[model samples]
Target: MSEKIALGNWGEELVAKKARCPKCKNAKTLKKLTQNFKCADLICDFCGFVAQVKTSSTNDINTLPNSILGAAWGPQKERMDAGIYTSLFVVLRSKSDKNYSIFFLPSELQVPEMFVAREPLSGNAKRAGWQGFLIDTTLVADRFVRLI
Candidate 1:
């Protein structure tokens, strides 16, 4: 019996938040003092249901697919909790070769500028862009997994 520390610090609250919802398949955002992992403007994938997720729940976000990670899609966009679910289509430029190689981001991120693509893609080009070679993500991942 020594010290009775009053739990009043903001950082303390973040330590308490551990519960995650497996049904929704994700973890809560870092404790933002706002509590409750919510997205009031968020729309559902299975149904048209609109609601916010309580961040207090202990959800292991890594269990979900990589499609939802750090991504904001659709009209409203809203906000989302990220994990392995987030992915990005990054364009890297090689000065020596003077070519652009589109790589998946985060995991594939390297030194910036040095790893930058040849040029920024215009919206028109993005819609109908062709890098000549068509390498599918699924194919690459599957091959890698087999090698492992």
Candidate 2:
């Protein structure tokens, strides 16, 4: 039997199938677990093959021309206060090198900071107020997928 794991409120689920290991080619032995609710860390137990799962369910967001530049999350207390469990600050980079950092709720994209241009944020800048480059998440439309 396969294990059905709920990937939080992203409306995405991981159906752990008994498939061949990508490295060893062993049959029906792959298992996966996430380190966070964001499902950022998906690992296979057999040959230690790591795979990234797409979290977006919409084509619009998936088709966005923008790219992720940076990301951050509120403190636990702040997250609970906002009535959002897993929140993030997503920094988006356009093709023209224009960067904007937006406060990303688990359900939607909010609080965008506008600037003509943005750099990679120095350590001092980050300490002051910048979250720097998030550069990991690829599913843009997943921001709009919400659970209420």
- Candidate number with greatest lDDT: 2
lDDT per model vs. reference: 0.25, 0.34
Off by over 4 Å in 1: 1-78, 82-86, 105-148
- Return the lDDT, model 1, position 66: 22
User: Residue-wise lDDT of candidate 1 within 72-144, one digit each (tens)?
Assistant: 1221122222311222222222324533322232223212121111222355885433222112233233222
Q: Worst lDDT window (10 residues) for model 1?
A: 2-11
The residue ranges of model 2 lying beyond 4 angstroms of the native Cα positions read 1-12, 18-20, 37-40, 60-148
- Model 2 CA lDDT for position 93: 26
| Residues 31-145, model 2: lDDT tens digits | 5454343313334577665433323222333243244422233332244356542233222223343332222333233232211123434767636654333333444445542
Candidate 2 residue-wise lDDT at 31:
51
| Model 2: how far residue 20 lies from native, Å | 4.8
- What residue pairs clash in candidate 2, if any at all? 69-134, 70-133, 70-134, 71-134
Scored by lDDT, model 2 comes in at: 0.34
Cα miss at 84, model 2 (Å)? 32
